[model samples]
Target chain A: MITSILRPPPIIARMAFFAVLLGAWEWASRMGMVSRFIAPPPSEVVPAIGLLYHDNELVTRFLRTFGQVFAASGIGAALGMIIGWWLHHNKNAGRAFTDWFAAIAAAPLVLLFPLFLVLFGRNASTIIAMGAVAVLPPIILKTKEGLDHVPPVLINVGRTFNLTRWQHIRLIMMPASLPTIFTGLRLGLVFALINVVGVEYLIGFGGMGLMIAELGDRFEVAGMYAAILFVVLCSACFFWFTARLETWLLQTR
Target chain B: MAVANEMISRVTLYRVSAALFLLALWEAAGASGLFFKGVLPSTWFIGKSLIRLSGDPVFWGHFSVTLFEILAGFGIGSLVGVIVGLALGMNRYSGQIFEPVIEYLAATPKVVFLPILLILFGIGVGSKISLAALSCFFPMTLSLAAGVRGMNPMFLRVGQTLNLSLMQRVRMIYLPALVPPISTGLRLGFGIATVGALLSEIKLSNKGLGHAAMQAYARFDIPTMMAILIVIFALAGLGNMLIGSIIRLPGPNTRRLTKDRT
Candidate 1:
C-alpha cells in the first residue's frame, strides 16, 4: 500500500487512503494497539462535537473568535496598506522601513503580549493587538511589492495623458495592486486568526480557543478534540470565503 | 528604476539613522513620562536592564530553554518535512493523496493544538518543543515540496543518462536544489519557533523568557519586562541572521536565490 502510494496514485487513492487511515485509527484504538485515551475514534469525537455544540456555548464562541479575526484583519489590512502606500511613495522611508521589516518579522509578536496585557489587560483588545501586529508586516511588505511592480509603461502612459499622480494612482495603481494586496490580506487574515486563537488560549478568554484550553484543563479529551476539529473547519471556511472574494474581485477586472 | 537603485544604496545609512531617531524618540517619551502607566521604558533603563539580564545566570538558563526548543523543533520538523516533501514532490500520485492534508494543516493554526500537546507532552519543554515542531512542519513541508517539484528537469535527465546511484543523484542534484527552500522554511520556522516556545511558556511553564516576562509583568517591573523583550528580539534577530548565513554559505547558487528579490 505504501509502495503504491509512492507511485502516481489514481483518483481512488485519496479516498482509499483516508478510508484506511480512519479505519486503522478506529480499529487501533478499539483493539488497544494505540492508547485509546490519546487516540479516540472519530465515532466518539464526532458525537462529542455535537454534544458540545448543544451543551457549551460552542457556536457562540466560534462566532466570537471569527468576529475577532475579521475585525483584526480589517483594521490591520487597512493600516498596513495605508502605511505601505505612504512609505512606497516616500522611497527613503520605504527603504528604511524594509530594512527593519526583516528583524521585526523575525521576532514573534507574541513576546510583546506582556506589554499588550499591561496596556489592555486580559481581554479581546489584547488579542486584537496581537493579531494586528502579526498581520501588519506581510501586508506592508506585499503592498510595497504591489505598488513597486506597477508596470513602468502604464505609468509612462498615465504621464503622457497628463494625469496627475493621484489620478494615475486612482486609475491605474489601485487596480494593478489589488491582486498583490489581496495576497497580503489573505496572509494577514491567516496570521490574524492564528494569533487571535493563540491569545485567546493564553488569556483563557471567551472564545473557542478558551473552550479548548478549558476542556484540556478539565481532561475532556473528546471535547477538546472536537473543539480542535471545529477550529480547523473554521479556518477552512475562512480560506474558502477569502478565495471566493479573490475570484470575485478578479472578475471585476 | 535607477532612482530606486540609488535609494536602495542609501538604505543602510537610512536604517541606522531611523533606528537612532526612533530610539531617541522613545527614550524621550519614556523619560518625560509621556508614556502612561509604564507603557514604555527609557532607552537607558532598557539598556541597563538588558545588561543586568545578560549577567544573570538565571536569565541565561531560561534563554537556553527557548534556544533548545527552537533547535530541537526545527531539526525534527525539518527532517520529517523534507522527507515527506521529497516523496510527495517526486510522485504526482503521492502528492495527490497527501497534498490536501498538508495544505489543510498549513491553513489551520497549529497553535490551536496546544491543548493536545500539553496533554500528551505535559507542561514542560516537551510540549513547547512539540508546538514549535508542529508549527514549523507546515512551512517546511510546503516549501520543500514546492522546491523539490521545482527542480530542473534537465539535471534529472542527465542523472538518468549517467545511471547515477540514488544517493549520488541526491547529493549532486537534489541536495543543492533543496538547500534554498530548506533555509527559507527554517528561517520562517525560526520565527514561529520563537513565538511557539515563548507562547507556551507564557501560557504554562515557569521557566523561559516568556515566564520571566510574564512574572515581571505581574510584578509591575517594567524594566525587566522590556529587558526580556529586548533579549527575545535579539535572539530572534540572531536566529534570522544565522539562518540567512546558512543559506548564503552553500556557495554562489544558493546566494543568488536570496539576491533574487521577489
Candidate 2:
C-alpha cells in the first residue's frame, strides 16, 4: 500500500515505447548508421528467427541446454542443502569449511573451467561440473538461512513429540525454510544456465550459445541475433516461472 | 580468559588447522600421483611456477592490461548506470514503463554477447573493456534504481515541508539514501566487470592472465595453469577488499531505517 502508484498507467504505453525502439533500430540499420554485421537490426533479425525455426536446429540445442541446466542445478542444490544443514548442526568445524566455500563462491567459477575440462573432458560433463560448483554456494548459504529461520519454540515442540532428524526437517524445518531454499534454487538455476551457455560457447558444442558463436563466426549476423534472442526469452521464462512458483507456495501457506 | 581473546583463539585454532590439513592432503595426493592423469599438479610445482612468472615483466604486463580494463569499464559503466537509474527512478510511472525491458536485459547472460562485442570493437582491448562495461552496467542500474525507489517516504515529506528545491532535496535526502545501495552496486558491478574482462580475454584476446592461462592449457602446461589460477583467486579477494574500502565512506543510514521500521 505504501508503494502504490498515483494511478496505474496504460500497458499500451510500453508497447508504444517498444515499437518506437524497433522503428529506430530499423531506421539505423537502413540508413547505415549501425553496421549490419554488428547489430543486423530488427528487419534482418525478424527473418532470422524464421530461418532458425525452419532449420529445426533451435529446438534440439535448447532442449540439450535445458537438460544440462536442470541436472546440474539439481545436483548442486541437493548437495548444498545437505552440506549446509550438516555444517549448521556441527557448529564450529562447519564454520571453517564454509569460510572456504564463501571464498570459492566469490571467485568467478566460470574461470575454473579448464580444470573441469581436464577432469571431465570437452563434453557435457565438464560443463555440468562447472555449473554445479558455480551454483553451490548460494544454495548452501540459503539452506543454512532456512534452518536459522526455524524458531527455537518450534524445534522444542518437535522435541516433545519425539520427532526423528529427518522428520524434523521434512515437517517443521521444511515449511519454515521452503521459501528461502526455493530462492536458492532459482539463483542456482540462473548460474547453472549461465555456466552451461558459457561452456558451450567455449567448447564450441551443442546449445543456443554454440549456435550464436557459430553464426557469428560464419558472419551470419541476423541468425546470431535470433539465437541470442532465444537465450533472452528462455531467461525471462525462468524468472517468470520462479516468481509464480514463489507466489503459489506463499499463498498456499 | 577474556571473551575477545577466547573468540580469537577459537577461530584461529580451527581455521589454521583446517587450512594446514587441506594443504597437507593436497600435497600428499599430488605426490602420490593417484589423481586423474596430470590434473592434480603438486603444490611445490605451483610455487615454482608462481615464482618463475613473477620474475617475468611480460607476465606483469598481462596482469596490468586486465586490471586497466576492469577499472576503466567499472568507472564508465557505474557512472552511466547511476545517471540512468536516477532518471528512471525519479517517478513510479517511468519504472513501470521500462520494467520489462530492464528485466529482459538483466536476464540475458551478458557474456553471450562477446561475439557481438568482438565484431563491434574488434579483437583488441576495446572489445574486452566494452564487454566489461556492458556486464557491469546492469547490477549498478538495478541496485541504484532500488536504492532510489526505496528512499524513506518520511524524508520526502520533510523535504516538501521545508520547501527544499530539487537540487537541495537530492543533495540532502536522496544522496544519503543512495549511499548504501550505490556501494552495493559498485561492489557487484566491479565483480562482474572483472569477470567480463577476463572472460573476453579467455574467449579471444591475445593478452591478459586469462590468455596466459588459456595458452598454458593449450600446451598442457599444468603447473603454469595452476599458478595462474592462484593469482586469479588472490586478485579476486584483493578486489573485494579494495571495493570494501570504497563502500565504507558513504555507508547506509541504518540508524534512520531502524527508527522508521519501529
Candidate 3:
C-alpha cells in the first residue's frame, strides 16, 4: 500500500493528493482546528448541495447567471472581432488606437459598474452591459494581436492564387488568426463571467452570486460552498467547451 | 526614418482628434437630452466634480485606503507566489501534479471565493486584501513555474563548473533567468489584484474608492459616480504605466532572449 501510494499513477496521484487535502480539511473542521462558521466540512457542503436544490433555486439561478454570461460575452466577442478586423485593415486607425485599447484593457473597468447600473437601471441589463464592457477591451486587443501576427507566408500563398483582399481575408487571414482570437474569447468570457457575477453580488439579487451572498448573510457556510461549487463547475464547463470548440475548428486545417 | 516619423505623427494627430470628437459627441448627447438628464452627464459636469472631489479630504482618505490595500496585497501575493513558484518549478513531479490545478483555479472567477474570505477575515480590509492576493497568486505562480522550467540546462552546468554554492547559483544564475517571467507575472498579477481589491470594496466596504463610488450611486449622484470612476481609471492607468516602466528597465535583455527562443 505504501509503495503503491508512493509510486502512484498520474491519475491516482492527483486523486490521492486531493483526497489527502480534503481529508485534512474534514479533520480540521471536525476537530475544531478551524471555525465551523467559515470552513464547513465537505460532509456538510455535500448535503448543502441537496438543500440548495430543494429549498433554493439552484438550477434556475445558475441558468440566469449563465444566460447573462452568454449574452454579455457573445456581444463582446462579436463586437471585439469586428472592431479588431476593422483595425487590422485600417493601418492608421489601428496605429492610432492600439495604445488606447491597451491602456483601457489594463484599466480596472469593473469600477464603472455603478455608472452602468445608473444608466441601465439596476436590472440584468446593467449586469450584462457591465460584463460586456469589462470583457470588450481584452477581446479587441487579442483579436488585433492575432490578426497582426498572422504569417506573411500565408498571405503570400493567398496572393499567389490571385485572391482578392476579401477572399484572402476570409480564407488565409481569418484561419491563421483564429487560434489567437479563441484565446482572446476565452479570456473575455472569464472576465465577463466575473463581472456579471460581481454585479449580481453587489446588487444583491438574481443568480448564483445572489445565492452565495444570501447564504453568506444567513451564515449558511455550507450552502455558500455548494453555490460556489456550482459556479466553479460553470466556469470549468466554459473553459472546457471553448477548448473543445477551438480544437474542433482547428482540426479542419 | 523620415517617412516612419511622419506616419507616427499622423497617427498621433488622428488619435487626438478622435478623442476630442468623442468628447464632443458626449457633450452633444447631454445637451440634446438623448437619454435622461443624469444618466449621461456632460463632460464639463464630470470634470468639475472630479476637481471638487480631488480637493475633498474624505475622498483622499478613501483613496489612501485603496492604495494601501493594493500595494500591501500585491506585495504579499508576489512574495508568496515567487517562492512557491520557484519551489514547484525546481521539482519535476510536483510541477506536473500541481500546475493543472493552479491553471484551473486561475481560469475560475476568483470573486466566488470572496464570501469565504469575508467569512474568515470579516467585512473589512482583510477580505479585500485576501481577494487581491488570491487573484495575484495564480498568474505569478504560473509565470514563475514556466520560467524556471524553461531555464537553460547550460546555466546550471555553468554554475556547477564554477563550483558555486546553491545560494550563489540561485542569486546569480536562476534569479537573472527569471527576470522576464517575473516582470510578466508582475504586470498580469497587479492588474488582476487591483480589480479584485476594487471589486471586493464595491461588494462590501466602508472605505476605498469603490465604496465612495457606490455611495454616489446610492444617492443618484451620477456625476460624482462618474468622477470617481474616472479617478479609479486614472489611478489604474498610472499603476499600469509604472509597472510597465519598472519592468522594461531591467527586462530588455531577458525579454529579447525569450522572444528569440519563441
Candidate 4:
C-alpha cells in the first residue's frame, strides 16, 4: 500500500487515492450499501452522457448556458471596472462606500432573482441580469483594491518622467492593475455562473440547470449526473480560458 | 487634521446624498406605473413592510428557521474543515495528493449537489442544512490548509524548546498562528453558507425566510419580498462584521503574530 511506504510520489498517491475511492464507491453501490437512486455507480453515469447527447438538447443547453455566462460576465466586468475606477480615483467615495460593496459582495445577491424575474419576465434576460448583478460587487471591490495598491514608487517614477495623466494611467496604472482586475473577473465569473445555473434550476429555464433539475425530478439519476458533469465541464473550460488569458496577458508585460 | 476632518464630513455628505438620490429614483420608478406593477416597490412601501415584519411573529418564526440552518451548517462545516485542513496540512504526501482535489471541488458550483442532497435528506431543513454545510466546508478547509502550510516553522521549534505541553502549544502557538485564517475562513464560509441555505430554501422548503420571500413573489407581494431580502442582507452584513470584530479581540501579541503570519 502507498501508506506503507515512507513517501510515495504525489502523482502516484493522487491516482491511487482516486482509484480507491471510485472502486469503493462502485462496490458500495452494487452491494446496496448506498441507495441506487442517490448513488448510481460510475458505470451507469459514464454511459448516461451518451443518453443526454442523444436527447439533442445537450448542445443547445450548453450553448445557452455558455452564452449567458459570457454576456453576464462581460456586463459585470465592464460595470464593475467603471465603478471601481471611480471609487479609486475619488478617495472620499472609496472611503464612504468601499465597505458597502464589500458587504454586498458577501451577501447572497442570487436571492435577488425574484426581482429580476419580475423585471425581465421569466426569460434569458432575467438569468443574465441576475448573474450580472450577482457578479458585480466582487469585481468592483477588487478593481478598487487593485488600483489603490499600485506601488507608490511606481507612481513616483512615472511622475519623475513627467508623464501626462492619461499616458501615466494607460501605460502604468492599467498594466499594474491588470492582474488584480483579472483576479476579480475570475472570482466574479465563478459567482455569475453559479447564480445563472441556480436560477435556471429554480425556474426550470432552458439550460443545463433545468436539464439537471428535470432529470432529477424524473429520477433519471444517471442522466442528472451527466448533466451535472457537462456543467462541470463548462465551468472547467471557463476557468481554463481565464487562466490562460491571465497567463498570456501577464507574460506580455 | 482639521482638513482631514472636513474632508471626512464632506464624504459623509456625499454618501448620504448618493443614498437618498438612489432611494428617490426607486420611489419615482415605483410610482410611475411604467414597469411591471410590483417590480420596483417604493422605498416607503418597503420601509412600511420592514416595520410590519419587525412586529410579525410569523416572520420571526421563518427567520429563526433560516438562522438556525446558517448557524448549524456553518458550525459543523467549519469544525470539520479545520480538522481536515490541519490533518492535510501536517502530512506532506497527503497534502500533495488531496489539495488539488479539494480546490477542484471547491471551485465547482456546489448547488448542483442539491438534487443528490434532496434525495438523501429529503425536502426539509436537513437538505438545506447539508447544502449550507457543503458550501461552507470547502472555503473553510482551503483557507485553513493554506494558513497551516504557511505557518513559520520557528514557532513549533520554540514551543519544543520551551518544553510546552500539547495543550499549551496549541493555545499559545498554533492558535495564534491559525486565528487569521480561521477568521477568513469563517467570513467566506458563513457568506456561502447563507447563500446555500437561502437558495435551497427558495427552491424547496416548508418554512424559512427564503420560502416566505418566494411566497410573497408568487402573490405579487413585492413589498414583503423586498423586506425579506433587506433582512437577509442585514443578517449577512452583521455576520461579516461579527467575524471581523471577533478576530480583532486578541491583544497585541496575537495581533502581531497574525500580521506576521499573513
Q: Which candidate's DockQ is highest?
A: 3
For residues A164-203, write the lDDT of model 1, one tens digit per residue: 8789889989988989999889888988888888788888
Better of 2 and 3 by lDDT: 3
- Model 1 quality (TM-score): 0.91
In the range A1-253, model 3's lDDT, one tens digit per residue, is 9977677766678888999999999999999999888788999998999999989988898899989988999999899999898788799999999888887887777777777777678689998898899778888988899999999998888989999888988999888898889888878888888788878887886698898889888988899998898788777777777778878877876
Q: Which stretches of candidate 3 lie over 4 Å from their true place?
A: A1-5, A149-168, B163-166, B250-262
On DockQ, the stronger of 1 and 3 is 3
Candidate 1: C-alpha RMSD after superposition: 3.5
**Model 3: lDDT to the true structure:** 0.85
Q: What residue runs in model 2 are displaced by over 4 Å at the alpha carbon?
A: A1-10, B1-8, B28-36, B161-168, B250-262
TM-score of each: 0.91, 0.92, 0.93, 0.93
- Tell me what TM-score chain B of candidate 2 gets against the true chain B: 0.87
lDDT against the true structure, per candidate, is 0.82, 0.82, 0.85, 0.87
Clashing pairs in 4: none
Worst 10 residues of 3 chain A by lDDT: A3-12
Cα lDDT tens digits, model 4, B103-220, are 7678777888899899899998999999999999999889988887788888878899999997887678877888888899999999999989999999889899999999999999
Model 1 interface Cα RMSD in Å? 2.4
Query: What are the iRMS values of all candidates?
Result: 2.4, 2.0, 1.5, 1.5
Query: Taking the candidates in order, what DockQ does each have?
Result: 0.63, 0.56, 0.70, 0.67
How much is the lDDT of residue B137 in candidate 3? 94
